[model samples]
Target: MSPATSLTRNQKLAALAFVLGVALVYYASHPLLLCRQLIIRDDEALYARLHLGNDLPYAWLTESDYSFRLAEALLQGKLGLTEPPPEWVNETIPLRGRYYSVFPLGSVLTMLPFALAHRLIAFSPSGAAIALIGALATFLFLRFALRCGRNFRDAVWLTLFSTLGTWLWTNTAMGGAWQLALGFAMTGELAA
Candidate 1:
């Protein structure tokens, strides 16, 4: 049998907690790593808000930018864009001569505060939000693993496999609002 399988329950619990701490640190920093890789597009600059390397960190002329736009609109006490969308924006429905995002409202709400506090989040609010939700998912996963009473080695392996082996990493790597909602939903799944 492996040495880990022979540890006392308290030892196992302590080790699991330490592993969780390390996992949290990793999730917290994951976004910064992702952000550094972003190449900002000149057109995306106006709404880029926070600039890492002063670059556009999002997709242009795509539905991916909808949440950011929705957030900007919500800040103005409306759900639809006040002015015409640029030719690049998509996945929106036209209503009452205004354009609204076709994506879930959850994304718009998630981006609202960041849009509202555009000056405070250091130009990467979307990334920061993704990071926060990712960390929460990590915490939930660790808790779930611990509650299952798996051995220390098994627990660590599970967390690593889930984080690296799954598309979870891919979703969090981008700053899209859909990705954020997906990550948040995954966090909810972890809690269940």
Candidate 2:
């Protein structure tokens, strides 16, 4: 074949390799890592509230315990707590009968797309979309690696190791509030 054709074919092969490598890493990590329940937890619940436009009660931030508040919020037709839990009764923050969330909103912003889709689909699988995000992050990492002058083979290996052999897989699969937040942050940073 001509040189141009050979180069084009080689480029296609490289692209295929990159895609397959990312897929392999994502699959080997399992679709769900440490998540046991489909119900949202911790900061994830807060993010869900944010997505639903629910007001976060400031009292919930007084202590680490949030399960009861979340349950109450869900029961009250609110996405998050509407009242302060007992633990915050003594605090001096002068809540003035208002709800709030102490956590940064970055993670919630990152999860908005997924949250919106979940809202649209009544029965969408809970953790699968996050796994896909992890996979996308791996793909981006591979592309970034290649752009940094690593050979295609080296880039593939590096991407695999970074995604599967590190906390990236754990966080991506677990779907914890912080883990998902960190994953999105890393993915965004790499893309930038």
Weakest lDDT window of 10 consecutive positions for candidate 2: 60-69
lDDT of 1 by residue, 59-176 (tens): 4322355787788888878879978886556567888889988888887877777787784644656555665665576556655665688765677578766765677766665656
For model 2, residues 25-74, the per-residue Cα lDDT tens digits are 55444323222222333545545544634365443322222322333344
Where is model 1 poorest over a 10-residue stretch in terms of lDDT? Answer: 54-63
lDDT of 1: 0.64
Candidate No. with top lDDT = 1
Give the lDDT of residue 183 in candidate 2: 68
Q: Model 1, residue 143: displacement in angstroms?
A: 0.9
- lDDT of model 2 at residue 172? 58
Candidate 2 achieves a global lDDT of 0.53
